[model samples]
Target: MFTTNPFDDDKLREECGIFGVSRAETASAIVALGLHALQHRGQEAAGITSWDGHDFHTHRAMGHVAGNFDRDEVIRGLPGDTACGHVRYSTTGETSLRNVQPLYAELNSGGFAIAHNGNISNAMKLRRELIRRGSIFQSTSDTEVIIHLVATSSYRTLLDKFIDALKQIEGAYSLIVMTPEGMIACRDPLGIRPLVMGKLGDATIFASETVAFDVVGADYVRTVEPGELVIVTNEGDIRSHRPFGETHARPCIFEHVYFSRPDSIIDNSSVYSVRKAIGAQLAIENPVDADYVIPVPDSGVPAAIGYAQQSGIPFELGIIRSHYIGRTFIQPGDKVRHLGVKLKHNANRALIEGKRIVLIDDSIVRGTTSLKIVQMMRESGAAEVHMRIASPPTKHSCFYGVDTPERTKLLAHKLDIGGMQDFIHADSLAFISIDGLYKALGETKRADIRPQYCDACFTGDYPTTLTDQDDVVVQNQLELLAERVV
Candidate 1:
């Protein structure tokens, strides 16, 4: 007997998703729908917290949103006019319900609830300092550090305290906070993570993606600007502030590449169109002679279409995916594991056999999946398998919010282009140039002085300070010195 595991992939994972609404009669229910739409961002756990004027209510569970928030009883129990929700895939904390978001606390001001999407790069250092100052933490999540910071701030107003807390933190964050006073939403200074504002009737909405707004039947408003904060009062008065001051905004480029849904818009560009552009650019940069262009399915479909159109080659669905399998499943044994790509994907033998094919994929991380996929093509009687990747090689790990392997483990870091081609057993392999990637984004080329987006995984040009990682390096050096002394 064989079983499939969907988590066996070579791609990066997003940190989390956040959705919030203010002054709505069915706030919790609306938030549930929004979170459901954004579920692809996180699948480990889901939570929602709402304020019903006088009291706060919460419901959290470990699993998909449909398993927990889909029940009518669950929604009815959480009665509130203002609500915020989170779906989490842990990046900086353990996989436990205690680390789930929509974390709540009662301060001198009133009840407070918050949901966050992004990693705090300096959380470990901040956690150490806060513990030294007698702060007690309820969860191991980095988001909890923000709660403690707000609780101890001397600022009289809740908004000021929240701003004060944000000032002390570093790295990416898009926060949706709910208090008895109202709902507050803000994006980090560099906009490393995404947050958008929308409107449903008189109700104000905030979510990690525009797709969530569509799910709730809300009118799409603009993205919450970098370093900008908006507070929706209990009485429904909206106020905007720029507490963090202006800086060069370098939003994560991966959102367009993989993180966001095709329908959603980020930084005023359509994600679907941007992906197609990337494929077109890839075709121009790495033109290949093949009988047909075949997408890997799902994520690769749009790019493959663009590649075919640009290269004047026929596009075909040469691979099919099984949607029935869940994100993860327990493998029965090694026999099943060796089945490899067949568990989730199967080659269209009639279409692939005796054909020279150009296989298009969004990106390659470890090359394990690519190797298996190429081997499957050969088994299906394909004459030649040319792998065409839409993005530049991923040589560095992401430190902001994406879950990526270390540099030593990255396939690109370990192998050059020729080595990768041999490792994957592909007839030939090519990736989009870094400058070509920028061209797809409407720029002539990437600016060496100040690149428009954060391509840290591709270019290794991190936009923010990496304080915690530096501290770790220093600590490891001291430990090694002590061992030598002994």
Candidate 2:
């Protein structure tokens, strides 16, 4: 029986979401609403840890934000002007409350709390080292490693301690740290994930997506640049710093294809528009002789619209997603995982029956789900499932934040296009070219400032490495990622 993980679950795994509030009177309440916007990223566990002048208070539960923190008392319990919240889908540790984030630690230097997005590649090695040095762990999450590092650092300054700790660990991270004085937001150098900063009248907010700022009525400031840090004080003084190994600002390309909301902007580009352009490019590159175009649904809808417009084929909603189904149950078994898929999506026979359909999706990971999806389309009487991926093949795993399959499990790594076509039982299959992907991102001008695309999953140039004994890999593909930022 296959275990359901955020990275390998039958249904899509929500990305991790983070929210940090500085100088807000109702920080906890604002965090709750922001978490709601980012709920799309993670659904397994929710937590908020706030630091008042005196101490830090934490409220965490193992469910959606709505269920875990729906009550007034829960939010009310976490009182503070500076706060940080996390919604997690456990890419590193088991899905238990013990691993849920916004990890609060009372250090000898002072009291502080941290909420982190993305995964650390060197967690296992670091954890073992910490254990040898008398660091006891309260949780299995790689996030806790930061706490240990911070506690053990010899640096006198808090920021220096933070920087020292960050230097030791490697991988994708957009961290929101809360202290009695202020809040600090930091993003990794390679920029494999998205993190943005915003502000209201007298408050500052940091989130994984721009939509969270809109939800909390905060004015969008800008994205926290790769390898940059923003520190906000209770007096409303915001300081920004960048201490990183030199690397290109290659934010995850998949963000535009799937992870980001269509409305959210990453690296100052509209996600929805970029995805549409990808579809349009796909149509130009691989014009299939099909009657109609069908989106995989939800993520695929916008791009499919672009594909339909560019391909001159009628866009059809050939698949429907069921929003009511619960993701997990008391039982942790294949039956539950299978039931989860059934609850999540189904084919629309009326729309797809006997149709010469062109399928548009963001990308294909393992051959299992895509293969199953192809079978569902065939069962719905799709005459020819001509699959066109919006992005190129994900042939490598992400050492950053995403839960991609290992290099070996990736179908693209194992099979050629023809092999994949046969494996998925599709009549025709074509993926967007790397050039086409850059064009979709609107790289028309010769602007060196915009950063290069990290097609690691497509090109096998990972930002970080997994040479250490840790199950997780560091954020930046040391050699490649280091050069990009430098």
Candidate 3:
């Protein structure tokens, strides 16, 4: 039981990344390229489904997109001018090939393929009701719940049925659906996840991030507006529909902090610029004197640069990360396995020795990696290690597609600022204030104005009703009562 990157275990992970292209000869290839750019979002499995007019072709595998989808044979088999794909990191379902996307099914309307990027908060409750109504399930994925909803919909037209299903569901979803009619892309009312539209020649493309379009030489058109659905007909007619009433958009704020690529443009602002702004705001709020500013590596780089520039402290690579680790490698014994952190990251002792340092990271979830990284800095002879987190302390769990640890397990939920500082063994630890985070996003405090993005993980102000979670609580109480009777 060797594994993927052990260092990533402490961070929040997005559940899926999706890409689709309509009316293009190179649809599958372009989608594969887009998924490659979004590989950071999900690494467990990859899938692609393409419709060749009369029939649908699909290829799915349990691994990264490069090895599975980059092959010519795989792309050749999926011959279609309309296609969509998904890369998954399972949160609501079992991790198996059966649960991979784009989850396709033959329906009365014709072949349907869907790639989903967010969770359905009421999926469990809906699943129970659907099951009782005799809708046999093929996979345990929440995404399949939508398929069943569409199948059972009594609305006359396929589009009408799809809209009816969307109205019944709650919580976040950015979906790219392919059908015999054409391709459809949409976002949830609150837009708790991200989805973007793009163009390459006359072809229409949809992806989880704008960076995806950049990869395949496509021009970004715009973000698919929250609660809005855009449909592209096989005959190439495109139309927009707003089934849900106008609602305040609440795109995930963490996208600017960690989930999205630095080069991505989110909400008309550069993600790199926003992270740097977050770092600058953090520096203003929690200034500390140190010899050099160090990033945790990769995702933390942009913010670190911002903190450094604002604080007038030189930025240096105090930690070096190795990117070539395999998904599963030979772990000889406990002693060797215990050195797991060293496999992916190492303390740059030469730069760290005898120096006081400031370490910048995107966020501290469980604080396990933070504690380990601080320990590494100490062992490398650093006099002091001050940890600065770019986002507000994540005290709540996210049910909207992110794989967040339970609230009880979150380090911020269990400990106050001082307690967490002590737990991680850093000289000091400070996360950006909630108000400061909004400032970085060019907004006032949430109390002064409507929230522009979903900061529920930090503030616990979830915008939607969590029916499945409530169901779980009721079920737990009933089970306890039954035990007492027994």
Tell me the tens digit of each residue's lDDT in model 1 across 298-402.
788878988999999999999999876666576556767768568678999999999999999989999999998999999999999999998999999888888
TM-score against native, each model: 0.97, 0.90, 0.97
All-Cα superposition RMSD per candidate: 1.9, 5.8, 1.4
lDDT of 2 by residue, 139-222 (tens): 999999999999999999888999999889887888999887688999888777789988877888899999998898999989
For residue 85, give model 3's deviation from the true position in Å: 0.5
Candidate with best lDDT: 3
Q: Relative to the unseen true structure, what is the C-alpha lDDT of residue 420 in candidate 3, on a scale of 0 to 100?
A: 98
What is the per-residue lDDT of model 3 for residues 330-448, given as tens digits with 9 covering 90 to 100?
54477676577777789999999999999999999998889989999999999999999999899999989999999999999999999999999999999999999989889876664
Badly placed stretches (over 4 Å) of model 3 are 1-3, 330-332, 448-450, 482-486
Instruction: Give candidate 2 regions above 4 Å deviation.
Output: 1-14, 245-247, 329-342, 444-451, 469-486
Q: For all candidates, what are the clash counts?
A: 0, 21, 0
lDDT of 3: 0.91
